[model samples]
Target: MKKRVITIICFVLIGIVQSNAQVTFQPGVKGGVVFSRLTNFDSDFMTGFYLGGQLAIKFNKLYTLQPELVYSQQGANSNYSDLLIDNYYNESIITVNNSVKHSLDYLCLGAISKFSFGTGFHVIVGPSLDFKVNDNFDKSYFYSDSPIGFDFAIVGGFGFSFPNGLSLDARFKQGVVDIYGNNYNTNIDNNNNGNYDEVVLNQSFQLGLSYSFDIK
Candidate 1:
């Protein structure tokens, strides 16, 4: 699947290059804050930041292809409880209040297609691939390891560019795949089926500003 995604990306890049002769290339840097949380987990949004650079391939007055490389931080604050067995015949009940902060960092590659309407206003939608760079969690109790290292998300947003080359945008990203292994077994079997029934995913909102300069 990774290979297939890489292949698609390559084809998109090739198409962009082939179409660039009639357009312009603009490069820029952006920085922003991200409000992120884990889905299917009892958690709250964690505030983090992202920094990146992007290349915008303007195909016409109304269409553009923007590709970016970004470093982003994401995670959540969670508090929950678990039941443990103290012995074969004795079950111990304990309440676990987890104040631990999880810090997950990723190097992401994203490609967005932009559609412009009036003036500098536009709508953007795209896909992103996140490669985990690092992660840390407070290990005071039984904590699940960070979700599988690679994540994929669908992104959508709106933005406007000023005549002075400054732009502002807000986007929402939704993970299309489970961050945790799909087959991971949870400790709780509410249905008494003896099988795990929980899954975790990633969701985030990003707000950013950038300055673009034409390169061609």
Candidate 2:
């Protein structure tokens, strides 16, 4: 998967360089803090950040499509009582109490549709695909491991641009796909040696700053 992504990026870059459009294409960096949560598990936000570049293609005076590749961090943390496993019928109370920390990181690819409001301001909305790079379950009350999964999200944001080719953007993104991997027995090893890991699909919100260059 990583190799394929690299190949695609290389091809895109080559094509851009070879194009003969009168429009300008400027690529710049983006980075900002993110707050995320896992549904059905925890409700607290995890602090994360992202840094990436965008390839913007200008179309006339009103709109453009920007494709971005960013390394983003997204996840959540829950208190021991949040799982509500402390009842006799609830098994895994011990495990839930033991799970102290958990997190997920993703490599994301997204496309943003820009509607220029003129005077260097634009509204952006689009879709993103997230590939989990790592998921961690840490703490004593639970198992000593974590699971892997993928995420799908929709993005919307606003920004301001400078006539000199610099821009500032702020966006909010939400996950529309279940982050959960699957369903299985809540019991760890059939014999109930431990508790089965629960996967939660959650929503993420981000406030980001990005710089864009114009190519014409």
User: Largest lDDT belongs to which candidate?
Assistant: 1
lDDT per residue, candidate 2, 1-216, as tens digits? 999999999999887766645455667778888888876674578888888888887765688788899988877766664445556765654433432446778889998898997678989999998888877754434535454567788999888877776777778888765565554444478576543335456567777777765433
How many backbone overlaps does candidate 2 show? 10
Writing each residue's lDDT as its tens digit, candidate 1 over 1-216 gives 999999999999999888766798899999999999988777799999999999988889799899999999997777666666566565666565547666778899999998987688989999999988887743524455656788898999999988787999999998766766585444446665533336677789999998889664
CA deviation > 4 Å runs, candidate 2 = 1-22, 81-99, 138-145, 183-199, 214-216
Query: TM-scores of the models, in the given order?
Result: 0.75, 0.68
Best by TM-score: 1
RMSD, every candidate, angstroms: 11.0, 12.2
What does the lDDT read for residue 194 in candidate 1?
31
Worst 10 residues of 2 by lDDT: 92-101
